[model samples]
Target: MKKKQWQGWGPGEQAEQHYLVEPRALAGGGDIRHVSEFLRACGWRDRSKPGGPLLMDSLDRSIRIAYDPFVHPGGWTIHGKATAHQEEWTAILGRQAPVEIVAGLTDALTRPRSAHAPNVWAPLQEQRWHTPPGAGHVTAVSPDGLAWMQFHQDPGGHAMWWSGAQDQQGNGWTAQFTATTPMHLVQSYAAALASPEPVMRPRGRVPHSARIRTTSVSVLPSQLSAWKQARVTAARAATSARNSWKTNRPRTTAHPHAQRGVRAHR
Candidate 1:
């Protein structure tokens, strides 16, 4: 069957064209969770386990690599004939851009545009410098203007963020994007060209937890005793409070002269 134009998990025209149980696909469809399950059910393939439809993400990463050409940011071609792009970036999302590249790309992407003529001035933006989506370009150049960088933001919905750069010698390398995406991507491209292990290059704040050795954690005997004492004290205080409340409660006595139904003065 002809795949849907988009790469994401959706039935599209595939439902009507291929094997799909309409009622099951539509069951609990109002909620997104059930809807996706229903769509997966429509494309159920494992005949041995007919009831269990494999999840989209659970599909091997190789599938995405195969579909890389049709993937987003539309301009993967600019990075040359590399298929590792999607697989690599998806693995490295939270990782950071290198330190050195960050400074240069900062100057590039955030460089003030000349109000006189933005066209005359390069179109510099703070984050992923805009391209005609999926297209890559010379997003930034070095301070000395000796080197330049390129980046491609996936035109598709996936945030598989990586970009490439080439130096004066025409050597190129790849780098990942962090949450600090656009500027850093611009920076990482330049840095990647210079550094041999660009992807593994360390940058950004070291997490505090990384400094500590993790051993089995347990409450000390003294701590446990203190906790027990505290609980006992709390229980005693609650009982004391309850008793005090009952003792302090106001009491009423009826007088012979008072109306039968009226509450007697306390």
Candidate 2:
């Protein structure tokens, strides 16, 4: 069977350039013997026609076999640490490994290794979120991996929003929202509204229900931290109050005289 191969390119390269391999040929390649042994241990079979030596068609094909040059000497050090932790959990739980075990394993495997860990799987810390000035909300949508669309809420409050999606075509369209009117009427009115010179008066007047304006503000890191701390303090106070209320309820209900006094106040 043909093996899958991945190609990588570095700076100043016009085209992608790399090599290929297949598992059977690694037995003769000195450094690749370790990989061949690992595969054999994993019970991989050739599964070709019986009574013939497994023949890898080409050197290119033979070299396409499993090899991860990116792995460090510690052998995915973060993964090793995580697996060790998981073994501890398995030992403690002892034969009650639920579906959560699989989920925990996946989390361990996928979590970021370190602040400056080399990213072999995907781009590192590239995704970002930012709200535009005077906009109520901003969201990013990516259809292809390369490009993204930023949708912004219209601050003018015409009950409309705007977004621009770029394609291969150079010229893109700008869409604006106008009051719902017949297309012909809208066109004729729009034409009339258009200035013959620089300054022109309105041909017909249209009434709007209300005018809307948005205020934009910038928040500092200290302000944001303060706000978060305030919220946490408020939440803790609320929880304490709730617990106090719960504790007091038994005493209030148990004592007839206290209940009577409370009822009289109500």
Candidate 3:
């Protein structure tokens, strides 16, 4: 099959191509604003200092988010501490990873939930990724052999899952999460990685690592711009709605009788 040329984003900084149904190979961290807005809505307070990494902490201080572009491997990190009755875990959605894909993990991490373990490999399996027989480590690789995901069971250390994608030129990126990371969060990542939706990128801006394997179709700049704008609009709308509710919500007052404690119930 004849593949289209990767039209680097043009001189106007417009999108040059759209990779259909792939995100792991997409260059750069995705729309991080979505992540920041989402965390803020979840009551995560931004503690980032000027010109530093975007650092945020949960209300109860059990979770933290760190997004640093300047540092390698520091990328987007979600750390969950073991409370008095809980265990600690960490997930790193690498710097080169797409923002939209990584946000799935963050969304799952922040949402309240009960404990449950879904088969994390189910998504990959359903997507037709293959696992080698008799492999010591659990792993699955895309049919094209360009992408692979795996989980390592380490008894003496943190059991972890990591996934990556690359081109023929040996350029690629990976994401990692510990076994203690919630199954749902892991599943969310698995699902996103297995998704068939194509990711849009400026043809010119494609990272060196993805160049060889990246075959993209040139798309209208507006197509990419509109997509980006839609996402921002949605996030802003959600924030506005939340703020409006907070502002317009009726406040409840304590009953005077209740305040009196009903004679101490003696």
**Top-scoring candidate (lDDT):** 3
Q: Candidate 3: misplaced stretches above 4 Å? A: 1-24, 41-43, 114-117, 155-158, 209-266
Q: Per-residue lDDT tens digits of candidate 3, residues 119-198?
A: 78888889898997876789998776777789888778757888877778755678888877878788888877777566
TM-score of each: 0.19, 0.17, 0.70
| Comparison by TM-score, 2 against 3, better one | 3
lDDT of 2 by residue, 18-78 (tens): 1221111111112222223222332333333344322111111221122222333111001
* Candidate 1 positional error at 169, Å: 3.5
State in Å the error of residue 257, model 1.
46
Q: What is the descending lDDT order?
A: 3, 1, 2
User: For this target, which candidate reaches the highest TM-score against the unseen true structure?
Assistant: 3
TM-score of 3: 0.70
Order the candidate numbers by TM-score, best to worst: 3, 1, 2
Error of 3 at 23 (Å): 5.6
Candidate-wise lDDT, in order: 0.30, 0.26, 0.72
The CA lDDT at 29 in model 3 is 58
How good is model 2 by TM-score?
Answer: 0.17
